[model samples]
Target: MNIRADIFSRLSRTDAHLFYLPPCPTPPFHSPPPQKRSPLHSRDKSKEKNVLITGTSLNGIGFESARVIAKHANLVIMTGHNSDRLNLAADTIKRELPSANIRPLILDLSSLDAVRKAAGEVNAFPEPLHVLIHNAAAPIGPFKLTVDNLESQVATDHICPFLFTKLVAPKILSARTEHYTPRVIFVSSIGHGIGTGVNFDTLGRPDPTRYVPMEAYYQAKSANVLTAIELSKRSKGQINAYSLHPGGIYTNIMNPASAPKEAVEGLHKLGLLEADGTPRKDATLKTMGQGAATTLVAAFDPRLDDKSGAYLNDCVAANELIGPPSSDPANAERLWNLTEQIIGETFTF
Candidate 1:
C-alpha cells in the first residue's frame, strides 16, 4: 500500500496496535502529540514560549530546532556534549537573532545517572519548559559500553529522554497557557526499523561482536516512539510526547567526519547523503533552521492538542504496520522498566 493508505489503515486500528514496527530489508517508503485539552483553549496557542532543544551541539536537527523556535519563541536552551560546539551554536544564534534567549549547556546523555541529574537541574530552571525537544543521540558505537554496561544507543536515546521527560513533566505542564498544553518532541529516524522489535528481556545488553550498530541505533529510536506513545497514555492530562523522522540528511550523525571514504560511499549506495547531498524543500540544503521545522510546529502548533501519542515524519503522522511488525510485545514496558532501574533513586517520575 502507499504511505497515506498505510497510515490510514494504522489509524483505523490504533486501539489494537500496541508495539512499534520493527526492522526490514527493503521496500523503502514511509509510515506515520499533545498536552491537556481545555474547553476552547486558545490561551496555549501563542507561538511565543520557552523551548529546549537537545543534541544540537553537532548542528543537525537540534540545531535546526533552535533556529526555527527562535523565529516564534523567545527562549531556547541548547543541550549537547561538546562545550565548544555548544558555545559556537549559541553565538551563531545570537549573531542571527541578536535578541534570542539561547542558553548552551553541556550535558552528555550517554550515562543514565547523568540524565537523571541533569533533569533535576533543568526542571528547576526559572523558565518554564513549554517545549522539550529531545534530539541528542549516538549510534551505539562498536566496542563502547556505558558504566552500567548498557548499549549506548538505548542509554542515550531511550533511557535518557525517558528520565528527562519524567523529571520535567510538571514544569512543562505548568507552562500551559490556560488553553495550551506542554509538549515533548523527539527527533526519531526511519532507521529505527532496524531494532527488529523491542527486546523485552535484553534491552540494554552490550556486545559489539553481536551487534549491528545501525540496527541497534534503530532499536533505540523505536523505543523512543513507543515510549512517547506510552507517555501520552500515562500522562493522564499533562505533558505530551511525540517522535518524528526528520527526513534524510547528510549530517555528522554517522560520524562521517571520522569514517573512512569507503563507509561514506557505502551509505551513498543506500541513498543517504550529507550537507550538499540533502534534498532541498525550498532551494537550500535543508538548513538546520528548516530541518527543525516539524519539531517547532509539533511543539507549538495548536493542531496537535490531545494528540499526545502521534508518530510523525515530515510533520505528518505515520503508520508502522504498513511497514513491518515489531520484534517484541513487552518492549515498551520492558524498556521503561530497565530505564527506571538504571536511574534508580536519582530518577523522578
Candidate 2:
C-alpha cells in the first residue's frame, strides 16, 4: 500500500481532494513583484493598511508571514512573549526590506490576563487593524497547565486567541471601508483532522490522565477552524475570517523526527521521513516561503473575499479537506459558547 496516499485518504474524512496532496510549490505564490518604490510608503499614508501577527519567532512560519506582510502593510505589528526574539524578527525584516515598518510587541498567549493586556495595547494602536493573523501554537510536550488554570496547549492555541480576537474586534471593524474589508486568519494545521470533534468534556481540564499531548494539540487546531467559521457567521460580512494549513513544512514546530515514536514511525512509513528519521528531501515538504503562502492568500486575496470562513490549503479553498465535525456549524457554535463560558466573557455581533 502507498502509505502517504493511504494516510492522507484516512486523514481527509471525505473522498474529496486530499490536503497537501497537490504539493505546494516553491515560489512566491501570493506576493506581487517588487515595485520601484516600497509598497508601504508608495501609497497614501492615510490609506495605508495595518497588520498584526502573533508568534513571529525566528524558526516558525509566523516570521516568514510577518516578513511578507511588512512589504505591503503600513505597520506590521510582530508579537511574541520574548522581547528579544520579537525585536530580532522585526529587525531582520527591516534589514531585508529597508522600508518595512515593523513594531515589536510582547504577547503571551497562555495567560488570559496577559492576552487581555496585550489586546488593550493593540486596540490602542494609532491606526485601525486591516488584518489579524493568529499564527502562534503551543509546542507539544508533557501535560501542563497555564497560570490561567487551563491545559497549556488549548489555552495558548485557542482560548487566548479567542479572547484577543473579541477584544480587538473593534479595531478590525473600524478599518472597514466601502472598498476595503478587514480579515482575520487562524493558522490551523492538517493535524486538525486528528479527531472527530472538540471534546468539551475534557477541554480546558488540567487532568493529566485525560491529556494526550498530540491529541490535545489537534483538538486545539480544530478549534481554530471552528472559531473562524463562527466568527465569520457572526461578523455578517463586516470582516473576513479564514483558517488554513500552512503545508507540511519542516519548521521547528513540525519536526516529525522529534515527535512521538509512533508519529516518527508513521512519517517514515509515509515516506515523509528518511530511513535515518530526518525529513525527506522532496516535494512532499515545502520551503518556508511555500509554507507561508496559504496564510498570505487568506490574508490578502481579493478572490477570497466572497469565500470567508473557508479553510484553505496550498493557497486555495479546501473545505473538503476538513472533517464534518470541524465543519458543522453547531459544533462551531458550541465551541464558541463553551469558550466564552470558560473565559468569563460574552461576545455578540
Candidate 3:
C-alpha cells in the first residue's frame, strides 16, 4: 500500500461513482503513493503532559483526539467557536478522565486579531504547553472574507494556527522545567488539492477561480503543511510540528450551521463513505468518526514524538502534499515563505 494512502484515504465526491465494482471494465486502480520514514512504533508511557486541541465540538477530530490523549496527558486544552458544545466537551472529558485537566477557550479563529488575543492568553499560562493541536478548520464554502479580510479558509486554517503555534513556541521550548515533547499538529485535508496548487498572489483574494470555496480550503491546508515543515526545520529539534490529514471520518464535516444546506444534502445524497473502513463497495463516502482517527493517532500517539514535521494519515506518516502538483520539499518551503509574507511576520512558532 502507498505510504500516504496508509495514512490517509483520499475520497472525493468526484470519485464516488468510481468506487463500485462497476459493470464496465473496472478502470485501472493505480498503485497508492509512497510512505515516509517510520518512527519507532513503541509509545513512551512514562511521561504526563499538556495538549491543546482546536475545533473539537461534538463528534469532530478534536474531540476524538482528546479522547485518545486524555489517558496520556496531564491536561488537555480545547478551543472552538461553538460555546455550548465546547462546554459540553470539556465537561465530558473532565468526567471521563477525572485526573486529566480540561480547559475550554471560545475564540473565533477567522480573525487574526482574535487569534492574537488567544495566543496572548496561552502565553500567559503559568505552565508550559507541550503540544498544540491545530485541528479546527473552516471549509471553503461561502465566498466570505474574515474580519481580517483574508479568505475564510486561509485565515482560519493558516493564519490563526500558524500564529498561535508561534505564540506558544517559547513556552514549550523554554520549559526545561519538565521533560517536554513540544509538537504542533495542524489538521489538514486532501481536498486542499481541489484542482491545483496554491496561488501565491491571490491567496486571500475573493474571485471566481480564486474564490472556489473548496479550492481555497486546499490552499489553506497546503499552507498548514508548509508552515509545519518550515517550522520543524527552523526549530531544528526544539519544536516538532506536523500537517496531518485525519482519514475520512463520517463526522458532520460540512455541517448545515457551518456550511451550506445544499452542500450537506448533496454529500448525503452521494452516499460514498463507510464509517468502519468497509471500502465503499458502492461509493467513496466516509463516516464522521472514521475521519477523526488519523488525527487522533497523530495528536496522541507517543510513537511520533521524535518524528515531528510529519504529515500523517491513519496512524502513520504520509508523503508531502497529495493530488495535482505532487510532493516537493522545496515547494513546501516556498509556500511557507509565502505564507509568512501574507501575514507579515516570520514563523516564530
Candidate 4:
C-alpha cells in the first residue's frame, strides 16, 4: 500500500534497484567548449556564463546547489525571500570559495509584482544567463491563499515559477551558442507520484473545505514535471529542460518542528523517517551534496542533451516512475495551458 514503493516498483528493475543506491559522484563540473571554436569564442571572455538559482536558504539543497555551482560558474546568482538569510548564504559561499562571484537577489514568490521585479533585474543584467534552477518550494501546510488569491503552495511552487520562467527565458535563450545551450532545471520530488493526477479544475483555487496538504504538494510537484516536459518540447532543441527528485535530505523544510505534525507522522509510517523523526539513514536519505547531485547532473551533464524532459533519480533517467499522468503529452499541454490561464498570460515558447 506504499504509493512511493508501488511507483518505484513500476520502474524497470535496473532503475528501480538503483533508486535504493546512492548517486555516483560526478567528475568536475565544467564542460569545455567543443574543440572547433567559433567566432563566439571571442565573446566568451566578456560574456561569462551565469547561473541563477532560487530558494537558497541556509543548509538546504538550494544553498548547496549554489555553493557547488559557484565553484565553476563565472557568476552565481542566489535568491531567497529574506535578504538577511540570502546574504548570509551568499557570504557563506564566498567564504568557502574566495574567488566565487556570488550575487544574492531578494525574491518573494508569493507576490506577482515581486516576481516581475526580480525577473526584470535578471533581464537587465549585462551577461547572458546560462542556467536557471527552480529550487524553491512552499512548505507543507494547510490550504492558505496568497495575496494573489491563489493557493499558497501552488502559487509559490508552480504559478510564480511559471511566470518567472516565462519572463526570464529570453535571457536564457540569448545565452545559447554552438557549443553551449542554456539549461532549465526543476527540483521536483518523488512525491509527484503521490497524487493520482493534477486537478486542473481547481489547481490555483483549491477549496480549503476539502484540502489535503500533501496531496496539494504532490500535484504541484507533478506540475514541475509537466512544465519541464512541455518546455523541452516547445524549446525544440533551443534549450534543455529537466526535472528531478533530489532524494530525501533533512533540511529545515522537512524538520518535524517546521513541518506539520500529521505530515511528520505520515513520513514515519512510510519508513522515510527514523523513530526519532530524522530522515532514515539509508541510501534513500542523502547528504546535501548527494541531494544536489541530480540537480547538477541535470544542469551540466552533456549526456542529458538528448534526454531533455527526463525525470531523473539517483542521477539517471527514470521517467517510468513518473507514471501516466505526468508522462502524457496531452496532459503536459493541458497543464501548460492551464498554467497560462491561472497566470492570465500565454507563453509562446
lDDT per residue for candidate 1 within 131-250, as digits (tens), equals 888888874346467776877777788777777787777788778667767888877767666447565455655666676666666677788777776666667657777877765554
Give the whole-model CA lDDT for all candidates, comma-separated.
Answer: 0.62, 0.79, 0.64, 0.78
Please report how far candidate 1 places residue 332 from its true position, in Å.
2.2
Location of the lowest summed lDDT over 10 successive residues in candidate 4: 37-46
RMSD for each model, in Å, please? Answer: 9.5, 8.2, 9.0, 9.1
- Against the true structure, candidate 4 reaches a TM-score of 0.85
Question: Which lDDT tens digits does candidate 3 get at residues 1-349?
Answer: 5332422333221112111111222122232532443222424331477778898787776786676566556777889887898999888877877887788887678877787788788888877887778888775466777787777877888777776776667877864344455777788776555557677777755565546555676677777776777788888778777777765554655445554543454344445333332335655444444455556555555556777778775446766345444245687777767667766778753
Q: Which candidate is the best by TM-score?
A: 4
Q: How many Å off is the CA of 161 in candidate 3?
A: 1.0
Clashes of each: 13, 0, 18, 0
* Residue 303 CA displacement from its true place in model 3, Å: 4.0
Q: In model 1, what is the error at residue 123, expressed in angstroms?
A: 2.8
TM-scores, all models, native as reference: 0.76, 0.83, 0.76, 0.85
lDDT of 4 by residue, 1-349 (tens): 3323332322221122212333343222222322322221111121355999999998898887787777667999999999999998998888878999988898899888899999999999988899999999988777788888888878898899999999998999999999887899999999888787787878866788877878888888998999999999999998899999988777876688777765676577667886667877652565576677778767876666689899998677888889679888999999999889888889886
Kindly provide the TM-score of model 2 when superposed on the true structure, using C-alpha atoms: 0.83
Error of 1 at 339 (Å): 2.1
What residue pairs clash in candidate 4, if any at all?
none
